[model samples]
Target: MRRMIVLGLGALLFVFPFYYMFIGSLQAEPDTTVTSVLPDPGNLTLGNYAEINEKVNLGTSLLNSGIFTGGVIACTVVFGVLAGYALARLRFRGRGAVFGIVLLVQVVPFQLLLIPLYVLIVRGYGLADSHLGVILPFAINTTAVFVFRQFFLQLPNELFDAAHVDGAGELRVMWSVALPLVRPALLTVVLLTFIGPWNEFLWPFLITKQADMQPLAVSLANYISNVAGRAANPYGALLAGACVLAAPVIGLFIAFQRHFVSTDIGTGVKG
Candidate 1:
């Protein structure tokens, strides 16, 4: 009973920030003090949401974010799966060297290449203020490839052998045999990839100066930095923007969270 109480308290502690943010977003007046945690019911209103929406155009920013995040997730999954399969299953002359290079790339931060990437995408490709340009640099994620490769490696070799004996090509074997057992890896990669681009502001801001093309992160950032202070209820307006930006990610995680369980890959092979 004592342990249960402790655990419940811990859970509440973790959830309080989100609860506070939601409640704060509904307030009609700015309240930054601790006493305002239990504000009067009369002060609650949806005006803050309306105000932030009017400024940011929540619908358009959300759509832009969806497109950008969706594209990155798609490209990351496809290329990551192919590259991971090659590294884990295929035997080639330079496989070790290639894998080493991938690991090396991970040690380097994306910021280091930002200048060159900007020049290549904007100057060379002439894709300024475009969704494709924003999506292109993040298309192939090395982290996702590493994750898929690790998961693929955990599978028993007998499954691949059986597929090969049955005259299945590499692609067929991967699709029918290998891919089914890596559900956890796919979900993990999607969630991980989703958070990065969804929360990313710097790169997107640099890529597109057009307000219509900007993602929610960039828009909310600009609002919080420049416009929120001028609002009637600055605290509520800022929280409202945060809630709007966070809602989809929270929803996506909730929807897919149940499928994050590990599969028993060893069951396919008879002992």
Candidate 2:
């Protein structure tokens, strides 16, 4: 009974926001107001969704997010794995220093780096307000490299040795042996990288001033601004927009939930 109650409460807490958003979205924009905490059920309508959809190019924002997220994941996987393997396996000068710097980089707050990065993108490279401008800096993730290195360090020497004996080169060994062995870590990196871009607000908001180039989070902010003094019906529509904006992330988590939830457990058990 205790477990049941806890589970029910947890489920309710998890579901409540989406439920409220849905309820808000269903009501007419005119009915959603500061005067009422809840929209009138009798006046529930999908018109808000239509209004929001008509105003914002949600499809473009979705595409931009997909591209940025995909690019970040691709860069992190390729570069992170290579750098991780080097740090884990290679014996060379400055290796420890490099790893130490990576640790230090992880400690540095992203907010601090924002100004320099923006200047570099806008003034230095002239990539201002471009998609590449926003994504390029985020491509190289220190934490991802660190995580991959830790997992790579735990790998036995015999695997590499066996591959080497079979005439496999470093690239071949990494491609065939190392990658397959660290599926959990790779998945974790991909998920984190994707999430960073998917829910990113500040960087996207700052970098992409143009409406069409903005990601969903930034677009949503502009959306709120547009509906600020509008009728209550627009509030319902705004809520609907919020739901649509959030759906992809929620769906992604739901789709890959098992992998994400079990990764830590699996790693702990294996260790």
Candidate 3:
């Protein structure tokens, strides 16, 4: 009973922020005090959402976010899977060296490369003010590659050998035999990749200043910095913008949470 109480309290602790954000967004009047945690139902209103929408075109911003995030996720998955499969299943010279370099790259913080990346992407490549500019830098995620490699390594080698003996090519083996068994990894990489690009404001802000091209993160940042203070209900308006930004990520996680179970890859291999 004590353990159940503890777990329930922990769950409530994690859920409270989201609950408060939702309630605060609905508040007609700005409320920051603890008393506002449980505001009167009569004080609730949708005007905060309307106000933010008027200030920023939510649809356009959301669409831009989708395009940028979608492109990144697509590239990350494709490249990550191929690179991972090669590292795990294929014999090649300098494979260990290459994996070591991937690990090395992870140690370097992305912020350190910001200046050079901005110069090359914007000035050298002339991709400024374009969606490709924003998506290009984040296209090949090393972390996703590492995750895929680890998952692929967990699978039994017998599966690959069996597929090869059946006259299936490398691509065919990966597509037919290997890919189906790594559903959990695929979903994990997708969710991880989604969060980075979806909430990324700095890179997108650097890539494009065009209002229509700006993603929701950039718009929300600008709104909070410049316009939210001017709103009649600044607290509610800020929370409303946050709600809009967080909803998709929360929904995706909830939908896919049950599918993160580990696959019994060894079942295919006989003792």
Candidate 4:
């Protein structure tokens, strides 16, 4: 009973902030000064959402987010899988050194690389104010590469041997034999990569000043600072933006939760 109480309390503690944000977002007025995190049932309204809609073109922002996140996921998957397969299965010169470099890159904070990356994307390449500019930098994620490499390594060597015996080239074997068994890793990387690019406001903000081209996070950030505070219910509008930003991420995780299990790519090999 004690354990159940603790678990329940922990769960509630984790969820209460989201609940508070949702409740505050629906209220007719901002609840910034209110001591209670719980909503007052009598005062609940959708007016804050309506107010936010009037101030920002949420539809455009959502579309931009789709484009940006989609591009990043696509590039991350293709290149990450290829690089990972090469590192895991292929024997090449300086392969260990290259892997070491990948690991080293992960230890460095993105903030440390931000200035140089910005200069290259903006001044060097002259790609400022462009979608390609925003998407290009995040295309190949090191974390995604690492995740794919680990998954590929878990694959049994016999699987590759069988494919090769059947006249399959390395690329064909990677695509046909290896990838099918690592669905979980793909989903994992997709979700991991999705969260970062989807929620990222800074790089996109720096790359493009045009509101139409900016993702939902950037637009919501701008609204929070510039327009949301000007509204009658600043806090409510702010929470509403948070809700909008969080909804898709929560939905994707829920949808993909079933696919998170490992398939043990070597199971067939041992059998």
Each model's TM-score?
Answer: 0.86, 0.86, 0.86, 0.87
The clash number for model 4 is: 0
Q: Compute the lDDT for candidate 2.
A: 0.77
Error of 1 at 21 (Å): 2.0
Q: Which order, best to worst by lDDT?
A: 3, 1, 4, 2
Model 3 TM-score, all chains together: 0.86
120-200: candidate 1 lDDT, tens digit per residue: 999999988999999988888887777789899999999999999999999999998999999877877777678778877
Give the 10-residue window scoring lowest on summed lDDT in candidate 3. Answer: 262-271
lDDT of each: 0.84, 0.77, 0.85, 0.82
RMSD list, candidates in order: 5.7, 4.5, 5.6, 5.5
Model 2 residue 36 lDDT score:
43
Residue 237 shift from truth in candidate 1, angstroms: 1.8
Error of 3 at 161 (Å): 2.3
Q: Compared with the true structure, what per-residue lDDT tens digits does model 3 show for residues 135-226?
A: 99788888778778889999998998998899999889999999999888897777767878898888998887888889999988888888
Q: Estimate, for each residue in 1-271, the C-alpha lDDT of model 4 and write its tens digit.
A: 9999999999999998988888888988666656657667877888877777767677888898989999988998999999999999999999999899888876777777789989999999999878899999788888677778989999998889998999999889988999999887887777767877798888999997888888989988999888865678888887887899899988887887674445422110101
lDDT of 2 by residue, 1-271 (tens): 9999999999999997787887777875454455445657677777877777777777887787888778878887888999998899877899999989887776677678889988888889988678898788778787778778988999999999999999998888888998899998888777666777777777878889888888778887887886546644667767877898788778878988776654333221101
lDDT (C-alpha) at residue 64 in model 3: 93
